[model samples]
Target: MHMVELKGVSKAFGDVDAVSNVDLTIREGEFVTLLGPSGSGKTTLLNLIAGMATPSAGRIEIRGRDVTHSSASERDLGMVFQNYALMPHMSVFENIAFPLRVRRLSRQEIERKVNDVLDLVQLPQIKDRKPRELSGGQQQRVALARCIVYNPALILLDEPLGALDKKLREYMQLEIRRVHAELGITMLNVTHDQDEALTMSDRIVLMNQGRIEQQDTPEQLYFRPKSVFAADFIGTANLVECEVSAVNGDRVRVTGAAGAFEVTEVEADVAVGDRVTSVIRPENVEVRAAGDDRESTGSDNPWIEAVVKDSLIVGGVVRHYLTIAGDVPVVAQQANSRSRLLLSHGDRVSLRWAQNDCRIIAC
Candidate 1:
């Protein structure tokens, strides 16, 4: 069953359209993320789903019930914001009990429910502490506990970890996923951080300029992006403009500013003489000393002579930035190993990658 469905949904403010003719369906208990850059209409679409903002057209249904015009309170959604919206004066216990109290739940019922959530969030010992006494991560946990205390059918998270530091943010991503697993509630998260979306989402809905650029599982979106925007935005990629020189079955040869290269797994309707962009992730390209014999490296792999412009060691990964064909730029990421030869600045090297690692997208 679909927990949420939006059909031809649109939201406009005067001449500006924040969300434009979007159709999306979220399955029950699915963890979906809305990922995009700022002003991409992700937040506006979340608001429409929460019923905080009314859509200009189309329909929204939650579990077969029309809620397009429902008030925020009527949507039965649990919302968590980046600010950790806990009452500063309230103890952890009181903050979690607020939702239940609003509904006039019996005191005994509220106590049992809040205690269960506290244990689920692994903060049973902090019930007596006030929000001001807790750490950022702890306070965020309290906010989350409060949201889930009533077991709302849908949870909306709007940059819920944005206020935390990088290390805390990383830790909380796992925590959120754990909670989602335990509760089995439908969750829709909004964030512009690609890594966060990649780590936490079962499926990522990438938005751009009030439209969905693509929606796919994280692995598919990263490994086989359907568009240039998706390829560039999801992760670091070397996008090379090329003209299709030849096509043979699933394999195609393309010549770019960096030189000739062959790419396999051609899924697009590509033909000879067509302009296309070949995308290869930095980690997929291997760097070897320029003097290496062609036969030593697989002959079928594409190799281009490049001069290393700079090299940086980041967390045991050596990133070599090279200039191919004099001006065309490419980056190769190699794991630091005992057998690896460290390439220094101005060193001439060969960049090689398997044809299957490269994706050809229409220009």
Candidate 2:
């Protein structure tokens, strides 16, 4: 059975629609992430499924049962929020065991379950300590332990790691992935952090303006986005507007203001002669002095001449911003190494990329 299903679901506050007609299904044991910007309805969608809020229209089901009108508790699901909502006065053991006690489990059963979860969270030693005594990561784990101790059918996370620092957040990303692997639990996570979504989710549901723009595996979403928005949102993308000049199965030739180019063929909502955008990552682009001997010469290798507009060195990567076709802009990133020359502003350069690395998407 599908772990959770939403068909034609939407929610609105006054005239502002929060979630628009979203149709989605999650299979058992899948980790799905709802990702978008601040106003993009990801949190609202999570609330709809958790029964924290009712949808203005359509149905929601969990495990083949309709729960559109059910209360959050009646849905038999557990939620972890951004705040790590642990009781300040309660001991870690009591916090993890509270739900089990409410369920009327025997004393021995509660002890066993609480200990097992504490161990699972790698916090067995802190069971006697109060929530405030633990570090942020530990408290987050304790909150997670409390949610999972009762073994709910589904686990919902709403930016569970948002409160931690970058280092701790990255650590907890793997920690949560490890826990999910061990338990084989179906998880639905809501977050605006694309890096977090890309790092942990099995599939990412990209939301835009209260609507689902695309849902796909992380690699697909990054390398084969279906629209200019998806291409730009998931990561850094350089968009070149072009019109289809030729199509030959795996390769497509297009002409744009940046000049004619060839890219990998993808399913286009529009066909031949239609305008499309070519998406390429900065890392995929090769930058060198104009007419450099390293620039390949072939019908398959298309290169454009651009003048360096600006340059910045971020960590080990040198990012060069260039303008081509008069005003059209593109970015190229190169490793900061001895062999790589840093381009100065107004320096003439050639930018080239593999045809396979260029993705064509009609927008």
- Residue-level lDDT tens digits of model 1 in 1-363: 799999999999999999999999999999999999999999899999999999999999999899999999998899999998799888999999999999999999999999999999999999999999999999999999999999899999999999999999999999999999988999999999999999999999999999999999999999999999999999999988999999988889998786887889564899899999889999998777866775534536666788999988888888889988859789888887777767788899887778888999998
lDDT of 2 at 77: 90
Q: What is the lDDT of candidate 1?
A: 0.92
- Model 2, position 170, has a per-residue lDDT of 98
| CA lDDT of every candidate | 0.92, 0.91
Backbone clash pairs for candidate 2 read none
Misplaced by over 4 Å in model 1 are 294-299
Per-candidate TM-scores read 0.97, 0.95
Candidate 1, backbone clash total: 0
Worst 10 residues of 2 by lDDT: 263-272
Please tell me which predicted candidate would have the highest TM-score against the true structure.
1
- Show model 2 residue runs off by greater than 4 Å: 248-250, 269-272
